[model samples]
Target: MKLYNDTNAFGLVSRANHWISAFLFIGLIALGIYMHELPKSPEKFELYDLHKSLGIGLFVLMMLRLVWLKISPNPEQISHNRFEHILAHSVKGILYLAMIMMPISGWIMSNSGGHEVAFFNLFTLPNLVGENETVHEIAEGIHGTMGPLMILVIALHIAGALKHHLIYKDNTLKRMLGKK
Candidate 1:
């Protein structure tokens, strides 16, 4: 199987990482929204637990992706214009920033709320921040707000990729999709 990305396409591993992270991010958002809407009940608790679990999972995947990105070179730029290049890089940078920060903020919020964060009913994550009502409230607000922003960013990213694929007929989407 392909191990490293080429100029025209991403490798198998990168594609897998990208898609897995995408699915997990979407799942976490859905669970979080549902949890927020639910009344104070055991079902809400369960949804929160699932949200925490998925957040931790996404964090792990993001860390792995960082390592992979550093070690394995990615496809070269498809745009020659400096403006386009900057825009492309900025979009990716924001996505990476959100992916890294969102889960960290969630963990801190949970810890501040004195909630136990578990990973798929496997192991419990240690609290990063001490319990405090104010901290919990602030962190929860930030964490909750960041989720929708991330969704927007991801949507823009996908739109740009599709534009490259269907309109510009460039290799941007193909590179990410592992196509040649």
Candidate 2:
């Protein structure tokens, strides 16, 4: 199968990216939740460090995906219904927004907390903002609160995919499943 989208369906690369991102997104949420629940200790701090690393990795992957999407043509519109098309597009847009914002907020929070952010222990990310207790608190609040919202939106996205695959029995989901 092709790895780039053409006119009929998603390419293998697109499907691969989607599934990889889905798994990573879920893992990130779980890690974030676990870190939040853990008592303040060395272990908690370690987990947070790993979480920060994963966030950086995710951000890089998302940037690559965005560039790929811009250059690779998308699958043809499967639904002619205006409402369905609008809903689909809206969900995609929101998903993209979440993907972009989540990492940024996390990075900002870390910077404001005077923490060094690293990616896979290979390279350090320079702090983009200066340390400020108030800014740190606000950024942390946003990062924590946005977690549940991300989960909700992800659930909706998955539900919509299932609706297309099982209920509607359309190619909409299959297109992203690497089916022609």
Candidate 3:
């Protein structure tokens, strides 16, 4: 199995992170939406805890992806045109930015609200800010607004990938798979 990406395809590590992160992110979005409709109860708290924990995992994965993408550059461009290349690059940039910021905003919101997010119950993240209602409120707002935007960008990214796969009939999406 390939361990690194080439001009034509992604390697094992990148594919692993990409697929795992995608699944986790989908779960997170689903959980977030579900949790909103849930009544105040232990189950709701459990869902929140699960969502936060998985989010931390996704954040770490995104960080690693950024570093990996930098060091292990693709051999060639999959994008056929300047516009496709630019748009794809922009989408990826926004996706990474949103991924990094979402967890951070959630962390700030939790910390300011005096609610701790324990990662898989293994350990709790450090609270960087003091418990302040205003900070908590602001962070909540940022997190709330960012979620839909993230989803929108992700949807567009998926559409672009599908276009490459079904319409373009290229290896763009195949490169992300375990095998090309």
Candidate 4:
């Protein structure tokens, strides 16, 4: 297996980033959902802090993933025609936007709510937006509204992978899995 992308397959690094981002994104969403329901308490606040920190980490990962995507060679589609290609590209574009934007909106909400994001408790990120209730509400609206939608897009992405693997029996999914 190659360590870098070629025409037919994704490289190890891309696969690594993709999988890691997926895992973290799922975990963060789950945590966010659960955290919102918890009663006011120390543990709840701690959980919120952790969630915020993980979100900031996700933002960092998105940046690095974007950089890696730009530097790496583009992988080719297995058997996509114009329509399928366009659909796949559209889904991917939206997914990328969600990945980048969700964390940012969350961060904006945090800062607007007068919260400092501590990345893994290592250091506190600067409060960029400060305390703005209107901004906080808007950001929270975006964050909450987009979360479920992103999950739906994620499901579609997975369905596409399954279609490629089970129905088409192509290496499309395997290529992303770093398989030959």
> Which tens-of-lDDT digit does each residue in 1-180 have in candidate 1?
787776667888788989899899888887888789899999888888888887888889899888988888677778757886788889888878888888988888988988878898889988788899999999888888988887888887887787788888977776677666
Sorted by TM-score (best first), the order is 4, 2, 3, 1
TM-score of each: 0.92, 0.93, 0.93, 0.94
The residue-by-residue lDDT of candidate 3 on 21-91, one tens digit each, is 88887778778888989999999999899999999999999989889989787556588889989999999
lDDT: which is higher, 1 or 4?
4
Candidate 4 clash pair list? none
**What is each predicted model's overall lDDT from 0 to 1?**
0.83, 0.84, 0.86, 0.85
Clashes of 1: 0
Q: After superposition, how far is residue 159 of candidate 1 from its true place, in Å?
A: 1.0
Which residue segments of model 1 deviate by more than 4 Å? Answer: none
> Candidate 2: where is the Cα deviation over 4 Å?
none
- Candidate No. with top TM-score: 4
Q: Is candidate 1 or candidate 2 better by lDDT?
A: 2
**Superior by lDDT: candidate 2 or candidate 4:** 4
Q: TM-score for model 3?
A: 0.93
lDDT string, candidate 2, 1-180, tens digits: 677788888887778888888888889999999889988999998899888888887888899898998989677667647887887788878878877888999999989988889887789998989999999998888888888888887888788788888888888887787665
TM-score of 2: 0.93
